[model samples]
Target: MTENTQHDVIRRNPLLEAAQEEMRKFERRENEFRRKDREERAAELQLPLAEIKVH
Candidate 1:
C-alpha cells in the first residue's frame, strides 16, 4: 500500500458538500431577485430587460 495526499484522491465530505449546497441555493435566490429587479426597472422605463450576468 502507498500513502497519498488529500488532493490526489476523491472523497466524500459531508461538511463541504453541505456548504456547496447552501451556496447553490443562495446563488439561485440571488439570481431570481436580480431578474425581478431588472424586469421592474425595464418596465418603469418602457424598455426590454437585459440578460443577467451571473458571476
Candidate 2:
C-alpha cells in the first residue's frame, strides 16, 4: 500500500469525523424538509372547495 493511502485512512482524527457526520445529518434534514414542503404544496393545489349561496 502507498503511504498516501495509509495516511488517508488514519486521518479521521475525531473532530473531522464529527464535522462530517453533522454535515451529513444537516443535508438529510434539509432534503426531508424540501420533500415535505413539495408534498404539502401539491396537496394544497389538489384540494377542492365548494361555495354556498346565502339568502
> What is the per-residue lDDT of model 1 for residues 1-55, given as tens digits with 9 covering 90 to 100?
2345554443546667888999999999999999888778878988744564535
Each prediction's whole-model lDDT (CA): 0.75, 0.74
Each candidate structure's count of clashing pairs: 0, 0
Number of the top TM-score candidate: 1
TM-score of each: 0.65, 0.59
Using lDDT, give the best candidate's number: 1
RMSD of each: 5.4, 10.6
Model 2: CA > 4 A from native: 1-12, 47-55
lDDT of 2 by residue, 1-55 (tens): 6998878767856768899999999999999998677667757887322332312
Candidate 1 off by > 4 Å: 1-12, 50-55
Q: How many backbone clashes can be found in candidate 1?
A: 0
